[model samples]
Target: MHRVRVLPKYLSKRLDRWRSTTFSENREWFSHLASHGQHPRAMFISCCDSRVDPVAMFEGEPGDFFLVRNVANLVPPCAVNRELHGTSAAIEYAVLVLGVSHIVIMGHSGCGGVAACYDKCEGVNAEWEKNTSFISQWIEVLAPGYERIKDMDGDRSERLSAFEKEGVKVSLENLLTFPFVRAAVEEGRLVLHGVWADIGSGALFAYDGSTESFVEV
Candidate 1:
């Protein structure tokens, strides 16, 4: 027995508004999705930041993408163990079951998770090291990204921007650690993309493997 509460009033009203407007307008589309099932072509891995909405950013519809969001948009290395892995499970389903052709890891500017990792590594934040702090451990996944940018000659903001993009690259590498993901890539069945978004400026960048850098897109 757990305490479950009703939807908040504001959200409830929003749901009603959606039902009357968006849902009503797209009833057939929704019905078709329900009947035929979703067949999204790409799987989008993105941050849980409210400002970063993949659907709106990509101008995509409901069944266009299988989306997985987490703090810092981090992907941990695949490991065999008894512990539950939510993100890994989502990746497995997206690749094997959905058979998506592309997987995108999108990082964003002003990410609090990335900022926390930056502070943690710089010894500016000790709260993340506490035994009871789950966030502390989760953001540790970005430590490798921090390492890549720590010594770079730049101001705080510049270093943070570099670190943010590095986090996307780190996730791309970790994505390959999954044998299924690697096999799919090698077999030409799937593609992996790294992207970063600047929230304030609405600018996007994509990693260009040829240049080994992120180029504005």
Candidate 2:
């Protein structure tokens, strides 16, 4: 039997090189950002999945988007709560404080959190139950898309794609629950978008409000 090396020397050297080059190249810009705080053009709500990095997916540079990530990227309706919640606080700060022009709720294909909501499990953690309550409660959010393609599905891949696209619409509807977010859109101060990214095909889909359809972005 052969044992694999735990930490490769080249990996560490590469990280060191990146730290020096990336930091030096953007040091002045980062310093200005720190001094003035983030004045981002958009706020992106996305899942906490390690594979689904919004900045990398969007090809964004530093301070380009005010990002919030959670188990499923589900935005709960804004309400006063005693305990400190990072996701909600981030949303409030992005909308009210930072005054972002756009709020994009991005859902992706092959989301473990969303899949978990559709399946039953045992010995689930209390924290998971607390955080994922919205996901279970909002089953209607993903139902329509599933229903639409259930009978006519060409293959497993096609069905899964439909499900992910539907989930985006569901999440977009959920975003309207936040009064500040809704009011901002109504007042023409903000715009909302539902986006789906297919990891298998490396394709990006954007929801067209007028046609109520998802188009490649």
Candidate 3:
């Protein structure tokens, strides 16, 4: 029989601390939430990067945001398919069921997924990203954004940063294609936001639809 590995002692200790302290301090709130269910105000879609902490970025409490983290923070246009679609399913639940008023697509600087998409679209032939790999296929969703900036007159890093923000634009546009999302927004019940973070400096940029550019927030 294959034995299941237990949580590491050190990591388990962290949970113990939370249970003993954090959970204890918020026991009443926890009990209420457990009974009433989550009613988050926002749905935050972000890149699955270790440095980009959605909670920390927003100083959020538990159940404050319906969070979905995926590669490059890319949102594919709404599709009905038999194949398992974790990202799309989460968005549907958040928008249609949870009734979240805000959808924030958060991307960040120095994102590895963005870099992979840039390289793949640029035909760099990276060995780590075989075309058949799951990551390769997932990152392909950002290919259009990469293609948009792959030839722009800038250094590789600058172009990569542009690509990251472009991914946010793509996601925001894609979110509207969902009928539920569009209905909610049109009824003045929902708002969409695009955010990019400079991971190195801990700075955030918000998309300004006015200028079609990101500005420091």
Candidate 4:
């Protein structure tokens, strides 16, 4: 058998410090969460960018939000095929089992996944469009958003910024494609939100469905 890798010293030291301080200070709260189980108020679907931390951004505690992270924070339309759907499965559990009241899909500025999708849709990056890359297929969900903004009059950076926000809107729309999610939303049991983050400036913009635009939050 192949030898297993050991944890790096830096990471091990950080864990030890967390266990000694943060964990020790919050032992009772952690125990309560373990015994009572999670009942998150919101389900946050966000990008897998290292700079974006849902808990830190929201100042949330354990069991506060059911967080799901994926490329570009894209949510594909509901498909019932036998293929494994980890994100969809997590969404299902969050909505049906946990009964989360809100679902937020937050995309970020300078998203590599969104950039790749833009490149793929524009027929510019043959490498990203290759069949072998899982990422190439995953961000295909953003194709519709690309179609909407591809012809807009803007520089590359501006278009990309719009595309990132558009990606959030696309995910929100896809979330509604799930019948259960739609039903819950219609029945007033759940609400959906789309947000975009400017990582450099620490700015957040929330999609206003009424205006069909993202406004600063």
Q: Judged by lDDT, which candidate is best?
A: 1
In candidate 2, stretches whose alpha carbon ends up further than 4 angstroms from where it belongs are 1-15, 79-85, 121-158
Model 1's TM-score against the true structure: 0.97
The estimated TM-scores of all candidates read 0.97, 0.76, 0.95, 0.98
The C-alpha RMSD of each candidate to the native structure, in angstroms, is 1.1, 6.2, 1.4, 0.9
**What's the CA error at residue 195 for candidate 1, in Å?**
0.5
Q: Could you tell me the lDDT of residue 129 within candidate 1?
A: 76
Ranked candidates, highest TM-score first: 4, 1, 3, 2
Off by over 4 Å in 4: 1-3
For candidate 1, write residues 79-182 as lDDT tens digits. 97998889999999999999999999999999999999999999988898787888888988889888889999989999989999999999999999999999
The prediction achieving the highest TM-score against the true structure is 4
lDDT to native, each model = 0.94, 0.75, 0.89, 0.92
Winner on TM-score (1 vs 4)? 4
lDDT of 1: 0.94
- The better candidate by lDDT, 3 or 4, is 4
For residues 28-92, what per-residue lDDT tens digits would candidate 3 score against the true structure?
Answer: 99999999999999989998899899898789998799999988888988889887788889989
The CA lDDT at 27 in model 4 is 99
Instruction: Name the weakest run of 10 consecutive residues (lDDT summed) in model 2.
Output: 119-128
Flag regions of model 1 displaced more than 4 Å: 1-3
Give the better candidate number (1 or 2) by TM-score: 1
| Candidate 1 RMSD to the real structure | 1.1
